[model samples]
Target: MMGGKGNSVFSLSPNPNHLCISMEDGSQSSEQLVVDDDDDDLPPIDDTPDLDIDLEEEEEEETRRDEKCFMAPPAPGMEFDSYDDAYSFYNSYARALGFAIRVKSSWTKRNSKEKRGAVLCCNCQGFKLLKDASSRRKDTRTGCQAMIRLRLIQFDRWKVDQVYLHHNHSFDPHRAHKKSSSAATKTTLPQPPLHVQVRTIRLYRTLSLHTPPTHPLFQSSRRLELRGGFRALQDFFFQIQLTSPNFLYLMDLADDGCLRNVFWIDARARAAYSHFGDLLLFDTTCLSNAYDLPLVAFVGINHHGDTILLGCGLVADQSFDTYVWLFRAWLTCMLGRPPQTFITQQCKAMRTAVSEVFPRAHHRLSLTHVLHNIFHSVVQLQDSDLFRMALNRVVYGCLKVEEFEIAWEEMIIRFGLTNNETIQHMFQDRELWAPVYLKDTFLAGALTFPLGNVAAPFIFSGYVHENTSLREFLEGYESFLDQKYTREALCDSESLKSIPELKTTHPYESQMAKVFTMQIFRRFQDEVSAMSSCFGVTQVHSNGSASSYVVKEREGEKVRDFEVIYETSAAAQVRCFCVCGGFSFNGYQCRHVLLLLSHNGLQEVPPQYILQRWRKDVKRLYVAEFGSGRVDIMNPDQWYEHLHRRAMQVVEQGMRSKEHCRAAWEAFKECANKVQFVTEKPS
Candidate 1:
């Protein structure tokens, strides 16, 4: 076994009988010797008591040192001794750690009576560590560290921040081993790990008392569950929904958790909401009632005949052009076709619009309108009873062209209206309108009946007769009224006293009868003039030539004197030059030939004139030929019957025999070819 020194420095020899010894400082040489038998039998010594005593002394020394370090009293406003002191220190320390702290007065203790009560616990304030820091700042003392925990509490409650101090102690190699003391310097501590639990603060504030939260006006359920801080409420009112007057009312009831000013709602938002169907109805009446201008309403009728409001727009000043485009677009959408028949008052604009959009459709002037215009014009002319009778004779009843001519002449003579240019123009286009009156159905009798006298002037310019029994009876009845109520007696009546003086007739008791008779004739002349002048005739030549003709008044009636000269070789080429200027000045030719022939050239009519005078259908003569060397001895009806029977026999024979069928087929093909050839030939 080695001595203590040798054993501590190196391992002993494994021989139990050998002994090795070395000096502690290694100055002496190591020596090895045989072990004594007597030493081997000696017992092992126990050193447990000695070791326990040494450890007890060491612990005692450490306890004394710790007590000495903690003995110093904390400075004012500093906490060092107790947990309360530590908590107070922590309150400021946590704020320095970037944790926002809120203190409540009552939160410090749970019971009012208890002085050493447990600190009311709550969530700690949170802080985030900076990404980069200097080495000095990042030192153990300088780094971020949690010093306190903040607790949230209800109003009127106290708040507290708890803190813990962290200290650093280590031996330095450079310092001498001596008993010494240095004043401690305060240093920033490292930040603690962030708290895992986070609590969001919510607040409520009353915006307005008038628009309360519980008010029925704030009926939108969507407005109730909004969540956010004061800033969020601001965004909701101003940025999101926009605070209109309506919305402002709703906002007034909102209790803001995070108090913030409400935002204004713009006019744009009001306009937007106003148009959402049932939300608000806009008033556009001002646009409609601005002027006395005429507006055409375009209404669309569905297949069910229900009208749909299409649109309303300003009417153009030029009515005709505007209506043309408007009605064209309207009809296209409604009926899928332009209107074929248009009935309207005698408005020039309406007429033009009809011609532009529905040229092919028949356009009829309202009889009521025509009559009204005629009545006004008739009031301007003054005539007598004969003229009145002649005018009535032509208007109320349908008569032949010759009768119309005779009545017209008589009316002009009686009225002294023969030299009136306006009256002459009225008769200028009689041919074009004569068909309308002669065929009563043309106007559905609206222009010819009970209101004949009233509607005549407006409808046509022509003669009317008073020969009917009804007219005669009315005349007798009127005479009886005149006898029973003389002018003086009529003037004295209370009903007549209030009546305004007649425009055309003076209130002369002596001339009342004459004025009444003159009024009738004036009305008759007006009707005749209006109807005759309504249309102007333009002659259309076969070769595409056109010319306008106006009726000329000779004395007081329209008259035409013209001679038609034909080429001897080409009688078809005829020229007509009327002393009335043909269609150049007036719209139509007058009948001077009838006057001349009836008065001076009777039974000596020219051949060319006779041919021209024939009716349109009678002027043409057809010559028929059967075939080469075959006379056309067949009567049209008999030949047609024979052809039909032959066709039936041919069909029967074709079905019975194949030879006949083949022959029939050949004949049919020949007939088809012949027909094709004929169709291809020039006229």
Candidate 2:
């Protein structure tokens, strides 16, 4: 056999019976096979001349012929009886080749009689049959055995191995098999673990002069308790610093050198701290030495009567900036929003801090401080009534802006105080103080208490003996006037009086007296009128039944009587009727005659005349039912319950109705089922 161009050729030589192959380039020659096919009786030849002959082709073929050479092949070792045996053989071969190999068993079988099995090779690369059949010599002999029927060819070499099985199947058995005998192999790298980091933060200073009662550091030991006993004091001081720093400072003034007594600070510092601080103090005792306690807290009622707490802390004496900074920090922490109004007794420190921290809040001087200054300015007014009057007008009266200006000018003139620098200084700030007196309502009652107290003693002092308080004087005055008017109406009979109580024995006498008194005056006027006429005789009668008058008129001795019957009972009854028509029309009475009959003790007054105009009875009206049993006019409870029960029944019956519908639907479906679907031919 010869391969195409430039290939080695194999041929049989006649002389030596050797198979020889020549390299296509004629560079080498080798013997491949030696065969002894020559014997004397081998064959008989036909001695006839052939029709065609090619001598040149025969000579060329002889020249190209050469002995074929074959190298020694691999030896056939023991066949693997099972995949495990095949895997062991391949792994050993791979190890020798300096490469690792793994094999997995795919399927297994065993018999009690023979102890034989077959398996599939499942190396990493591809699947292959490891064994057709294999046997164990004895039942006790336990070893995996199989035959390997597949091999891998790679490069110029071939590898034989069992296939690798993953979960019961081969995984790339072909690659594993091909690489089993290879010198080069890939390796896997190891993986690393992940890492994370965290940090902590703190918000405020943790150290304190006083630890809380529940501090974790203080366990059951009394020593810990003693060490942390100052914690409560420190917390109290801190709270004082937060709520009212100035009050805290003022209290500290009395204890000069003591650590708890830092109140006697420098004048400048004290003044700076005092601004708006007076408003924070509920009472003057907060500064007094009477209470020895280091911490004091109380609510200060402002002009509007709102309670504000005075909180103070006693700290060791510190610099002005240190105190101010501490106060600011305390305030910012304690009050989420700044104070709306701040009053002080002219302290510089408070004024400075308030201006900076609470610019929007109203800042004012305490009225007490202002009054003290005012007394000094008006020393001459101690005894003068005119001076007192002027003070009252300017400071306590219902003084308008213009009126106050006039009164202020009069005071300056009357007191001869215009040239006095002190008074001028006071008047210079008149606009601020003037509002305190001019307005009826003030921001703080504390500021206006002196003026209001002075005005109270004089109001409603004359005529009325009642010593009414100024606060309720107006209401009391109006009530007193109402009682006085009621007394005056009782003394004067012409004016209406409250109804007189009636007695069963003479029930109608009082009512009759009222009516008869009115009628007698009317009858006297009619008799005078009759006497003035030429026909003069007239009889006037008032028996409390009704007013009656008869007039006699004569001409030449012929006389006629003219009678007038005024329906008093009808008019009185009409007045008592409750339709209020009489009150609406003439503000008095109507002609319902039942009142007169009742007043005279008549049991059964004629109803026809009493209710004449109102004879027709009003029909009773009712709401009508309009829908089909949906609405009801009577037995509302039964109606609602009936509807509710009917709704539930309808819902319950819906399923049965639906079932009936479903049965009909199924019948329709059966009819539809009977019709067979067919494809029709087109025309």
Candidate 3:
């Protein structure tokens, strides 16, 4: 049917049952045309066999395309028109690279229809379930960190702000090709160069083209250098997964297969972050574990004005790269939500890493760390009480920005620190530590390092401390989560069942008790109670509907004056602002603001002033039965497994005491009755 110049030429393939034949005319041109070879003498092929052959070729072609995709991966700053468009682009890249992606998480504003951002991730990004696996099929998920994050910039434009294309597992392009290549014939076909095959094999084995030898991640090295307590820690994590699949952890394996770094978070922490993730306090000075790894705690403030654990990381070293890796892991686990404010100690590596990783976040130095720096950097300032006093005044006692600047200049001049590099650097970064310069920045409840200054009420403080074993830390971490979530459950029960007695006869007080969490309501109650002490109000000025006044409050023997401003807008709308910035910092009104409200004859608290994060009745997607964020809500299998896990949790909790057991029994019976009635009803 075809000829090349003179003799009939057939395209050579290892498989003689190939469908297409290559042909060329007698012309001098070198192009060959492919066509179906309909040999009249050939025997008929069965439909099923032909389908099988076509499928075999199709699979082989797919495998080849997948291998080729490794050469190209998405980079950060890639832009798209919509969240779906960004997701589709990343999903195609994942498919082409022989992996799967899923919606890790996405967030929309409270009353908005469109999403603010979304985190699409590798399907295998988190840990695989360590539950009973005898009846389950093999899963390919090995906690791969490969993912792409999409952030909505503005007006329907989404940008790929973060991209991670490294997979911890290997993909074999030889799967289909090796199977098809078995169909041999007495014919020689072309093959790629030997160097190319070797290069690909090395790539498959190492996956370390950009990785340094010391931190050879996902390398196929059998030699392991796992240090003290790491094995026990790994076993402990495995045991945790056995109990609940809600815990996620990531660890680095060196070129020699050493486990030196790890990060972990649980379902409760993820759900808490969804609500209270605006301000983050990242601290690492708490512990030096058995392996000498620095334990970093990701902390957030709850509605209770208490520090809660968001995640924890044990790094290999204090390098900027290591912290960057830890930050990226935590961000990915939290669905790529960057905090509005980030607080940490003033370590150069940490500061640089925070700035680079969370570019949009306001990185503030811990007040205690700032003091420590001042003491160490200016050793002579400690010799004279006058010098130290002046420095403290500049750092802490300033009430206004102008006052702070004047105090700082006077302190530097009085101490003769004009040539000191540390003082100059501190002056350059004054906005990072000085509270006078940062009154506008919201800090939630974190004004300084939680562990350094305040009594750390977190359960971890009781269970974890310096020089602890990795296993001890993990065990304590798990125990604390169990207790913390139990506390939340108890508080939820109290909020739903009981209301606090009103300290004030105001209708606003009654509404607050119902709207706020019990702890937050108590904080509000304190402000209302203190309104009695706030007197001697004098109008400073008035313009349009707005009025500014000075209010004096008595605290002990000292009477402090505060600047308060209010606007009586149309429709009974009242706005209050205080120079104290109590609502801005603590998400609650100050006594001064409350006094202004009473003066304006406004009975109820402003609806706009009530923060949604402090609301008691809001439901969250991650808090569905207090479940993890890793579960794909759209997947029936994941939902069934999650529900089953929740049922098991009830069984475990009910075993704790007789009261819990009885209550759980009654609840289970009632639920079963409803399910049975539904099944019995006509469909």
Steric overlap count per candidate:
50, 55, 0
Q: Which ranges in model 1 have alpha carbons more than 4 Å from their true place? A: 1-319, 336-340, 347-352, 384-390, 419-683
Q: Over the stretch 332-435, how does candidate 2's per-residue lDDT look in tens digits?
A: 22323444445443334444545655576565554545555566566776555566566665765422456667878888787776787766766665644444
lDDT of 3 at 342: 92
Q: Write the per-residue lDDT of candidate 3 for residues 96-192, one digit (tens) a residue.
A: 3455555666655544455665666665566544563553745555777776655555566665545566778764333223212332121132332
Best by lDDT: 3
Tell me model 1's lDDT, rounded to 2 decimals: 0.29
Error of 1 at 126 (Å): 37
Q: CA lDDT of each candidate?
A: 0.29, 0.31, 0.59
> Model 3 Cα displacement at 418 (Å)?
5.4
Q: Can you write out model 1's per-residue Cα lDDT over 196-270, one digit (the tens) per residue?
A: 011011111112245555653323211211121223333333332222211210111111111111112222222
| Per-model C-alpha RMSD | 47.2, 46.9, 17.2
Clashes of 2: 55
